[model samples]
Target: MRGLDDHTYRKRTAALKAKRHDCWLCGDPIDYTLPWKHKMAFTADHIQPRSKGGHIYGEIRAAHRSCNSSRSNRVTTVTTAPKTALRW
Candidate 1:
């Protein structure tokens, strides 16, 4: 599915940062100052999987990129890969 545009992404991310949101996965604070590619960067996450028709900000929360990737498309607890602790 298509994701939020850059403009919308920026606006929404900024708003969450303004609210000082913490990572929904690990209870860590989101560092909005970091770029999205950073492991600790703030990302918009769906409480439900988007592939299951979830919408941004519908059931969304802020998460770290690593945290979100680690949680992708599942309701399972976050797990670390043996080598990297990341799915990638």
Candidate 2:
């Protein structure tokens, strides 16, 4: 995102928001009208992190500001434990 100009950045962010997608990280609704600094505000997140050599214009997804900040630049993967019945 370093070389991306303000216009392009705005355009990209707008496009992402226009998709009306849920937060990719937290799976929650995004409040498009919220202020930029607000935790639940809409944000454009790179599917692959920029700090991890992801392209500036690479695949982008909608996310809440808080979710995006919490993810940082780490690789994302899903881990689920084997299903088992539990007795109370």
Candidate 3:
């Protein structure tokens, strides 16, 4: 997250709010009303990731703090188990 200061983060948050975009890591809605430190609060996400020499800009997207942390620097898919009927 180098080069991505608070100013850039604010801009990304505003952009996401304006467009009403969903978090890339999770499909849940981001609650901008919450404080930035909140888990569900809006945060900047790097699509390419910063750990793999990926810059902190350009490929950036909006996401929730929890989502970004869960996703980390790698791509992942999250899903729930399918419901099943109980035997009589």
Candidate 4:
């Protein structure tokens, strides 16, 4: 996988955090103050998976560290199931 260097990663994270974007994966707020290893910590995720031949400097979106790691190079689509009510 094409991983980012420490400087690039931190730079990207800071930029995203400054924008106050929600995690594109799980739609949760990123805790930029948290340590890098924290589950809620901010991370930059590739718009396309690197394992699928995505470019190293391609578009990226903000994500939580755990959410990004859980994706694990798989293509993901986040959707919440619609709520249904029973009719008597």
Writing each residue's lDDT as its tens digit, candidate 2 over 1-39 gives 345566787788787788888777777678888999999
Candidate 4: lDDT of 13?
56
Q: Give the TM-score of candidate 4.
A: 0.70
Q: Is candidate 1 or 4 superior in lDDT?
A: 4
1 or 2, greater by TM-score: 2
Off by over 4 Å in 3: 1-13, 76-88
Residue pairs with clashing backbones, model 4: none
- TM match of model 2 to true structure: 0.77
Among all candidates shown, the one with the greatest lDDT? 2
Output the better candidate (1/2) by lDDT: 2
> What is the Å distance of residue 33 in model 4 from its true position?
0.8
Backbone clashes under 3 angstroms, per model: 1, 0, 0, 0
- Summed over model 4, clashes come to 0
Better of 1 and 3 by TM-score: 3
TM, every model: 0.66, 0.77, 0.66, 0.70
Per-residue C-alpha lDDT of model 1 across residues 12-62, encoded as one tens digit per residue: 767766786778788767778898799999887877787777655455678
* Candidates arranged by lDDT, highest first: 2, 4, 1, 3
- Model 2 pairs whose backbones collide: none
Candidate 4, after superposition: displacement of residue 63 in Å? 0.4
Off by over 4 Å in 1: 1-10, 76-88
